[model samples]
Target: MKKSITALGLMSGTSLDGIDLALCSFNNKKSGWSFRIEASETVPYSAEWKRKLREAENSSARDILLLHNEYARYTGEVINRFLNGKTKPGLIASHGHTIFHQPQKHFTFQLGNGTFIAAETGIKTIADFRNMDVALGGQGAPLVPIGDRLLFSKYDYCLNLGGFSNISYEEDGQRIAFDVDPANIVLNYLAQQVGKEYDRDSLIAQSGKVDDTLLKELNDLPFYNEKPPKSLGKEWLDSELVPMLKKSSLPLPDQMRTLYEHIAIQIGEVIHNSGTMLVTGGGAHNPLLMERITACSKAEVIIPENKIIDFKEALIFAFLGVLANQRQINCLAAVTGASRDNTGGTIHLS
Candidate 1:
């Protein structure tokens, strides 16, 4: 029998939609791992859970710590049931829920207890993959680029339309990635104003014309002017975007329209013309937004297999965990502007 490597990669994206659990089998050489996604599901968060996570940043330190262990145990329980006690994975690689991320302050927090997970599940785990980079003066972000570089290198670029629009591409042998702009985050916020979670196929956006004033202001935000190795967070949106949009008093459709275009321009500027970009994530389902991106950049947008669209982040985080398990360099200096290219992640045993 061949040696088998089974991994369960967990991701809780910015959308706050739910937890994406991906089980995959890796059986091959270091550069030639063949993976078949065993089973996957998006366990939607309850209304109460969503509310707590959405307001978690402003909550007390004690509550955040409590939630940290709570989430960790919840994750372990989920994994246990997913396995059904039938099989045990070689590794549990978690991209734990991000609660606080402020690289400038040299502090970042992702709340899921790997140690607690190991203790509870009696399974080896690796997690908290972002803090060390920040401690070393790095953005501790876009860690998926390492996975992009290794697993999906054939494409010129990989753009994920998750809660936020982010792109990762190779340039002269170095990989680059950053939050392009708000994707579902802004659009969904506008959608909620009209009692919708998201605009299916970007119908609301297609129904309205772009507000030039709003579009121009969004394009000129100081964050856009920053070169690279930068990222966005809920805090920035709360402080900058929400207030600006609320004060604009523009119709919701116009806000969605302008925000969609803003995301297009933000992403379009980074990818080269005519380059093939493998686009994925829930936002890839947005036809109007994809149409705008194609219009803005004139690039070839390719959506791969449905599984890839829905679970690529979870898959790539699995790859990141594998690299970290091997004690290899998984975060790049060029990408996150870290002081050094570092092997990041902590491991916990049963």
Candidate 2:
């Protein structure tokens, strides 16, 4: 490895909050390695792009392709603006926005085009991190556990409270991970009803009553009954969750409250909820929801520094790109249900 390398980590999660760009420097010293985040920013999405992304689940195939190309260009512009032509990084690692994630069908799509990123940025790019795993009969979702195991193993377990909730932990010394429940995705939908971006700190949940019936229905969803190596996307939310949420006559607050409990319960059971649980992601900002999970589980929810809590996945995706460059395994067998641990991702040379 070079004495040091700079990485521009980019992420746009399901929360639809914005794109997070982290300029990180990694140094390998005699004592292993350490990373220092130098500059970072959350680039809010334009309203047009936001609507298109949220409504992309049912978009026409032609439109999906069009958006895929457009989004990749948009991503490149964002990265350039963030860097201001400063030090050029060795490469770019983008967890392109997930457009369709259905591993059961043996397919997944993260739309931002790697070729476009490479052409626009004139640097090597790595993307499409999940499809190869799905092709290998693995759950293409929850790909971050590879990074969780390699980069943040100090914690007994790591849970990302992102657009959806997922956990990464060691089982029998092998990394195991999967989606726990829908987090900000459902919560933010309800929050939008109240004319806000999200339930700021999940205060709305604290103000509402938990509808037990709705909670029961949510917890009983077939996805929860299924085993790991499973994942959920907006399509699942629209097909399964939206109908369930719509069938209930409950008001927005009650809906949010019940959904909150569902997330808490599913997440609690997935992880023992014990030991140092390194929780990060946009949903980590949801205090009331976190409090409820804490009340239900005997786990120490450790919210790391804001940069990590917000952009850890972006950072890890960048790290995954590095591992790919080194021909190291970036996909864990136990985590993805693959036949073996594999290095999965497409690399684009400048």
Q: List where candidate 2 sits over 4 angstroms from the true fold.
A: 28-33
Model 1 lDDT on a 0 to 1 scale: 0.85
Clashes of 2: 0
Residue-wise C-alpha lDDT for candidate 2, range 1-350, written one tens digit per residue: 56677877788898888888887777756765577777788999988989989888789999999999999999999988888957888988888888778777878888799999989989899888887788888887677987786678799889899888888888877777888888988888888888988888667877779888888888889989888777788889989999988778888888998888888888888766468888898877777788877776667878899989988888887787777877888888787887777888899887
**lDDT for each residue of candidate 1 in 26-54, tens digit (9 for 90 to 100):** 66575665677777888888888888788
Q: For each predicted model, how many residue pairs clash, with residues at least 3 apart or on different chains?
A: 0, 0
Candidate 2 accuracy as TM-score = 0.95
Clashes of 1: 0
Q: Which candidate is the best by lDDT?
A: 1
Ten contiguous residues minimizing lDDT sum, candidate 1? 26-35
- Top-TM-score candidate index: 1
TM-score of 1: 0.96
Q: List candidate 1 segments past 4 Å from native.
A: 27-33
State residue 121's C-alpha deviation in candidate 1, in Å. 2.2
